[model samples]
Each structure stands twice: as C-alpha cells, then as structure tokens.
Target: MTIFQVTLKNCAFYAHHGVFEQEKALGQRFFVDVVMDVEAGDALGSDDIEQTVHYGLVYELVEKIMTGSRRNLIETLANDVALGLTAWSPMIRRVEVAIRKPSAPIAGILDYVEVRVEHRN
Candidate 1:
C-alpha cells in the first residue's frame, strides 16, 4: 500500500478569534495550514481530481468557517479545520490543522502563537 499526502500552507485570513472584546471587535490576522493523508485511489494514476480531496473547496470551507464565526480560541479554529477537512471528503483519511496568530494579546514578544489539532477518520 502507498500513502499520499497533500498540504496547503500558510493561508492567511483576517478574523475575530480571541478572548477579549477588543480582539473580537478589532480582529487580527491568522495563518492556517492543513495537511491531509489522502486516499487518492485512481487519482494517483488517472490524474483525476474527483478521486481525491479537492483542496480548492477545502480552502473555501476554511474561509467560510474563519470568516463566518467568532470564536474565543485559535484551538477551536484548529480543531474546526481538522474536523471540517475530514468531514468534507471521504478520501481524506486523516488531517492536521495549524493556526498561527501573529497578534496574540500576550505581554511577551515572540513571532506568533499557534494552535495545532489533528483528526482521523
């Protein structure tokens, strides 16, 4: 047996997803990365997209979730992305989602804060 993996890295979105009212009202930038273990089936040999997970629609689903809802934690965002990806396509056997928040409201100086989550089907 062989394994096929697909990755979409560092997709950026602006949204309100934090623990403060200011964070909710003001919003911040989030970078999302998704990796999936894909059961490509005939897609690997036949070059047909229909036999695998559609990453374009995957991005759309991520966009919809990020933009449509207000959440208090990036952990929720990560979990949602992982769950959504696995649910969106039966061809996706497993998924990992990472969310990076560059403007996290912490008193320390760092590159960013990230939350990662994984889901398996």
Candidate 2:
C-alpha cells in the first residue's frame, strides 16, 4: 500500500483555551499543525481530487474545532483534532495534531507551550 501525507502547518486562530479564568477571559493566539496519512492507491495515478484527501475540507474541520469550544488543556484540543481528522475520511490511516499556545500564562520568558497528539484508525 502506498501512503501519502497531507500536512497543514501553523494554522493560526485566537481562542479561549486554558486552565485559568483570566486566560479564558483573555483569549490568546493558537497555532495548529495537522498531518494526515492517507492511502494513495489510485490517487497518485489518477490525480483525482476525490481519490485523495481534500485539504480544504480538512482546514475547515480544524478551524471549526479550534474555534468551537474552550478546553483547559491544549492536549485535549490536540486529541480532539486528531480524532476528528481520522474520522473524517476512511482513507486516512493516521492523524497527527499539534496545538501551540504562544502566549501561555507563564512568569518566565518562553516561546510557546505546545501539545501533540496522534491517532490511528
């Protein structure tokens, strides 16, 4: 079986997702990266859109999940994205999701806090 991957990186959104009340009240920017492993049996030869995973639809789904509800942990958000993407298509064998919180509520100087989740179907 031939496998292909579709990756969406650094998809940005602003949402309320944190453990603290202040963090919830004041939303911060989040970045999401998704990688979907797909079976490309005929897609490579046929070059048909329907044969392969549609990234536009994937982006929409990711956006919906990112902007949908508030979660206390980015891990939960990442897991949700992984599960959601794996269920979106039967051709998808695995999904990897990463959520990054750049403005995490920390005292010291840091770049970001990120969580990564992977799901297999």
Candidate 3:
C-alpha cells in the first residue's frame, strides 16, 4: 500500500482535560499531533488537490477538536479524532493522532503527558 503523510506538529489548545474537578474547571494548554496515510498513487501523477486530502480540511478537523468540550482522557480524544478524520476522507486509509499535555498535575517532574491513537479503514 502506498502511503502519504500529513503531520501537524505541536499544536497548542486551551481546553479542560483531566479527571480532577479543579483541573477541569481551570483549563490548560494541550498539544496535538496528527498524521494521515493515504494512497499516493492516484495523486502522484496528477498532483491534483481534488485527488488528495486537503491540508486545510485537516487543519479544520484539528481545530474543531481543540475548540470542543472538555474530555477526561487524551486517549479517547485522540482515538476519536483519528477515526473521525479517516471517516471524512475517502483517500485516507489510516490516521494517527497524538495528544500531549505538558503541564499535567503531577508531583514528579516530566516533559509532557501524551497519548497516541491509530485508526485504519
């Protein structure tokens, strides 16, 4: 299967995503990463926007997730986003999304909290 990749790296969003009540009440910044796999052959020759996944639409999809309501877990959010993106585009055979929280409420020091999800159609 030929593959085409679309990656949106280090996207920041202000949203409530935590289990604790205070955490939900006070929203924090979260990062998102998205990648998509598409059949490249069809668009390889023509170089037609119509034949491939439009990058603008991908951005819109991600924006929607960022602006949407609070979620308890990034895993669920990532999975839903990946599945939703693939479902919207016929050319996409699979999609992968990663959501990261840098300032998680953890006592221990860490760079970030992240979850990755993959979907295949």
Candidate 4:
C-alpha cells in the first residue's frame, strides 16, 4: 500500500477575522495552504477522479470556511480548516492547514503572521 499527497497552496481570501475591532471592521487578505495525505490504493493505477479526493471540492470547502465566519485567532481558523478537510474526505488520512495573515495589526514591520494546524484519522 502506498500513500499519496495532494496540496493546495496560497489560496487567498479576503475576510474579517481577528481579535481587534478595527480588523473586523476593515477586513484583510488571508492565504491558506492545505496538504492532504491519502492511501493511493486503486487511485494510483486507475487514474480516475472518483478513486481519489477532488482538489476542487477541497478548495471550495476552504473558501467556504474562510469566508463563512470570523474567528479571533488564526490558530482556531487553521484548526477549523484541518478538521473540515479531514471530515470532507474519508480517504484523507491526514490534513495540514496553514493560515497566513499578511496585514495583521502589528507595530513592527513584518511579512505576516501564520498558524499551522494538523488533523489525522
């Protein structure tokens, strides 16, 4: 038995998710990266879409989660994404979700604030 991985990276979404009142009101861009590990099984040989997890569906799920609600912490958001992806596909043995806040309200000059979360069956 072999394991395969599917990754969706740098998925950008603009939403209001933050602890600060100003952040909630102003909104900002968020980037999400997801990696899903699945048992290759027949999918590897068959080359069939049905045999493996659909990447588009995963993207849609991420988009829904990112735009759906507001959370104070990126950690919570990443956790939600991990859980959501795991639940979305039974074939997914493990899921890694990373959330990046580029315009986070910070005093010093920085690239971004990021949080990574993982979920496994």
Backbone N/Cα/C clashes per model: 0, 0, 0, 0
* Greater-TM-score candidate between 3 and 4: 4
Q: Model 1 segments beyond 4 Å from truth? A: none
TM-score: model 2 vs. ground truth: 0.96
lDDT of 4 by residue, 11-108 (tens): 99999999999999999999999998997878988999999998999999999999998999999999998998888788999999999999988999
lDDT of 1 by residue, 1-121 (tens): 4569989999999998899999999998999998999886888898887777888999999999988788898998889878878878888888999999999888999999988999999
State the C-alpha lDDT per candidate: 0.89, 0.92, 0.84, 0.92
Please identify model 3 stretches exceeding 4 Å from their true place: none
TM-score of each: 0.96, 0.96, 0.91, 0.97
Root mean square deviation (Cα) for candidate 2: 0.8
Alpha carbon deviation, residue 24, candidate 2 (Å): 1.1
Per-residue lDDT of model 3, residues 1-121, tens digit only: 5787878888888888788887799888888888888878678789898888998888888878766867788888888788779888878888889999888889999999889998888
The stretch of ten residues in a row with the least summed lDDT in candidate 3 is 62-71
TM-score of candidate 4 against the unseen true structure: 0.97
Which residue pairs in model 1 clash with each other?
none
Cα-based RMSD of candidate 1: 0.9
Q: What is the C-alpha RMSD of each candidate to the true structure, in Å?
A: 0.9, 0.8, 1.4, 0.8
For residues 1-121, could you state the per-residue lDDT of candidate 2 as single tens digits? 9998899999999899999998899898999999889999799999899999999999999999998988999999999888888888989999989999999889999999889999998
Arranged by lDDT, best first = 4, 2, 1, 3
Indicate the residue-level lDDT of 102 in model 2: 91
Q: Candidate 3 versus the native: TM-score?
A: 0.91
